[model samples]
Target: MTPGALLDLTDATPDPARMRHERHARLVASMREDGVDALLLLGQANAGYATGVRVPACEQARALHRRPVALVTADGADPHLWTWYPDGAPAGLRADHVHPGLRLEFDADARALVSAVHDVCPTGAVAVDEWTMPLRAAFDHPVGDAGPTIGRAKLQKTADELACMRRAQRINEAAVADVKAMLAPGVRGTDLTARLLERAFALGATGNTVDPIWQVMPSSIASGPHTLTGDVIFPLCTTTEPFARGDVIWVDNGLQFAGYQSDFGHTWIVGGAPDATKRAQCARYRAVVDAVVDAMRPGVTARDLTRVARAVEDGRRTPWLAHFYLGHGAGTESAEAPLVGTDLGDAFDETVVLLPGMVLVLEPVIWDDGHSGFRAEDVVAVTETGAERLSSLDFSDYESTR
Candidate 1:
């Protein structure tokens, strides 16, 4: 498998200080465009994006309860980080904006956070990525949803972000491939899940790094009847149920690296090659995916992709196959803005136009009731000319010799 063209590691790894400054600048520009005077960031992804400090996953639970917030103004000034414990702040944090030693409850902390925002920008409307009752009562000015603006800011990938995502995707594909090789009639679903995690870690996957860290998401492994029907139910095969011959094993998983993610799925038929019916179904699914991939390019809107996907399904005489989303933007979170297809309705801001530096995952699925299902997902990075597939694993063959 050939790796896609990527920036060299030396070039891709930006100095942490400089990276944070760049991110802050971009976010401030977005705020100005959106008419936001200041931002109160609550989401972990947004906080990390604004500060370049990796917020530990363990802290997220506390954040949800206590609300760890970051305040940034529209002038690109250094953001102020507010949390319950400033003494335990992440490394290299500037003490100027770090507000530690605060109460965990909403009223006190919300007052402190609002006061901090006022310290920076006293008179304009304050937007927040997430809001609570306490925040609404404490702030005097208007509070708007900052999720869309922050999400759009994250849509375009920096060179470092793209490189890290590419590496994570390669490692993820390798680990999934290892688990697929163990797909035998007697292998338990839990066993495969365990092996996937083991392989991912054994290959240097991590959740801590300023450059290219990674963390594996919980895997969805299903086989036999589970793979034969609607919605591809997850955790069904995560039981001790053993695989049976002719059972279709479907695995959907992802790995997060340097705050970016690699999300996709692949299906393997146990024991031998699929029969004619299964082969035909797989072919049709492949055709649909290929069509979408071929159409991915700069200036194409999500709505346009939706239309293309619908036309393909219609032409195939299997319109029912268009059940789920065609694809979505892949980044810090596995699923982000500019969601492709799946009836977005009239949300103009949500239907994003494809741009260079946007990474997307094209996933299409085909299923037959009481029979089997097929799905193959690939990651592609949009470029000045077109898109380049970052995932190099060979998904062409679904048959396993186990």
Candidate 2:
């Protein structure tokens, strides 16, 4: 790891309350730029980002039973949070903005919610994080998708948000280290997954602050040829297949703290030592990762990084080793915007300019038809001058004892 990377990980923490206020301010500015009058935040992440209050996991069960929502005006007014029960409001919420009456009756119609919205913001077109048929019917005014607007606002992270994410990454590293320490021949993928979950909680992986939502995403663990074939999809299913002596172990996992997420992966060989061939493959993958990270900086476009990755791959004798795009932005959601790739296809919008305060993961996947696959990921934050690595865990190959 670079000295700059070490400094980035050890930066001073910021006050959470202050951070929330700054984030809200940015959202308000974004709303103004988009000409939105008010925002009706429906997505859980969107609500949490706008207001410091996060809907607890317990209340999530009532999602269908009732609606817990937030309303923030573009004019920089204090946001309003509506929940079914008064107790559902987070302690951090301001007393004035907490409105418990927005809850609907068991058989109540959408008119009740519509009336509540009108009461909050008397008139004007509203932007909704997610639009539902009922919400559309309730509002007589025009409603537009607030996803893009909110997403753009979230692209830049405040100091406090970065601090929480850094902490999450530290906890994630410790948990994954624990699991790596237990890897050996004959160990099953299920065994590693179990240990990962156990260590995650032991190391203060308290899910997200929104409610102790533990490991909502399952660990992705694969061994032997399964690693190379990419047959084991994410959120790996429980499997009893034993790891072999020379098998590669790929563990792609995630953990969250205070609603922020830490997502990364590392590769290891089951035996204590890797042969020359495996060592070379690991070095090749590391070079790809380093190239991508070096290319990440403010003012660089996603296409620019893609071009650099292509150059690196073209220089390699075996260009077919790379199988996926270089990486994507990481934040509130594991995979966010500003994806870096040559052809992201229809799934991702390929055009985006990298900016300071943006966090992204550089994951270059390498695979072969019958051999094993290898990949290492590192999280980086675009800095004013360049890029700083947020994830401190080493991506180099590790050899587990037998």
Candidate 3:
């Protein structure tokens, strides 16, 4: 068999500090426009985006390729990083390269973080990404009320972010092919999961989720919480119900290498031909994904794309399309904003158009609740004319090798 090569794939490149500076300036303008005094990036993703630091350990898991947080003021002053990680951490190195003027401090101590923010920008209504409490609360203060600032900024993706996302997509595609090649007719999900992990490590991923992609949600089988336990895997192929003549194998896996993630899923048939009903259902789901891609032009909203996906799924009585949202934004984190869900309104919000440089993972699945399911996911970049598929595989012909 051919060995995996240490190939250097080109990634989205941006002047990290310059990007932060521009964002700060935009925030300043936004503050003036919205009448907000300052903004505090409480969520790790937002904070890292602003200041170039990885703060929360949990969020750091996804920070395999990027910084953790950036806190800026309405005036668009130099952002500060809140974290205990020394300057030696990867995030710190990234910050150093891009944001030489950024401030760095630890939030747990309270004195430094709170004092620094107060010293820099004391007055005005503070805005924060309240949804990201896991990384927030580290630097609590008696300042102005924190509003929704980071969420607004995060909803939109810059050119640099899209580039990084494209690289992640390439890495994920390679890892998936490598891992799937190791599977046999009756390979246990646990074993297959480990093989995928091995491939990810070989490809230079900083960190990975303990749970295999096949066992995760929207893929079907509900395995036990913990990762490995004597190989009684629940999702993909099981020891009890190993790959049968016509079993469908869906791999909903992810890879986070160098602080970026590529989350996508694909389906395969066991040894023999796939079931007719399932194949048709997969076809419908694939068409739905295509519809979303076709409608993903600039000036389109999550609502508009979601409508297309929902319409296709509703057209068929398939469970996959109806149960889950079409797709979501991908970057330093696996799941981000601008999601296509039922919560969307009448039309795609022109306010949040599908602009160039935004990287997205389109995952439209059909879940069997307990018995079976099928999914085909791919990472794509929003170009000027339309979206570009980043995966090496032809999503139109996604199939299982085993």
Model 3 weakest 10-residue run by lDDT: 97-106
Give the Å shift of residue 224 in candidate 2: 11
Tell me the lDDT of model 1 at 181. Answer: 75
Model 3 / residue 392 / CA error / Å: 3.6
> What is the overall TM-score of model 2 with all chains considered together?
0.81
Regions of model 1 farther than 4 Å from truth: 1-18, 58-63, 66-68, 83-93, 101-104, 208-237, 317-323, 346-351, 399-402
Clash count of each predicted structure: 2, 1, 17
**Candidate 3 segments exceeding 4 Å error:** 1-32, 54-70, 88-108, 130-147, 216-246, 272-276, 311-314, 318-323, 344-353, 366-371, 394-402
Higher-TM-score candidate of 1 and 3: 1
lDDT of candidate 1 over 1-402, digit per residue (tens)? 322223234333435555567667778888999999888887767877886645444445565775456788888767887665443355566777776634434688778778878878888868888766776788776788998779778888777777778767766777776777777888877787677777766764554222111111112224323444434443232557677776676566776666667774766776778777667767777777677778778897776766666677774433223444677778777778667765555255245788988988877766664555566677888888778887754655633322
For model 2, the superposed segments whose C-alpha errors exceed 4 Å read 1-12, 55-68, 83-92, 100-109, 208-240, 315-324, 342-350, 395-402
lDDT of 2 by residue, 304-383 (tens): 77666667767543322223446777777777776766255423433588889999877765554345556667888998
Question: What lDDT would each prediction earn against the true structure?
Answer: 0.67, 0.67, 0.57
The TM-scores of all predictions, comma-separated, are: 0.81, 0.81, 0.73
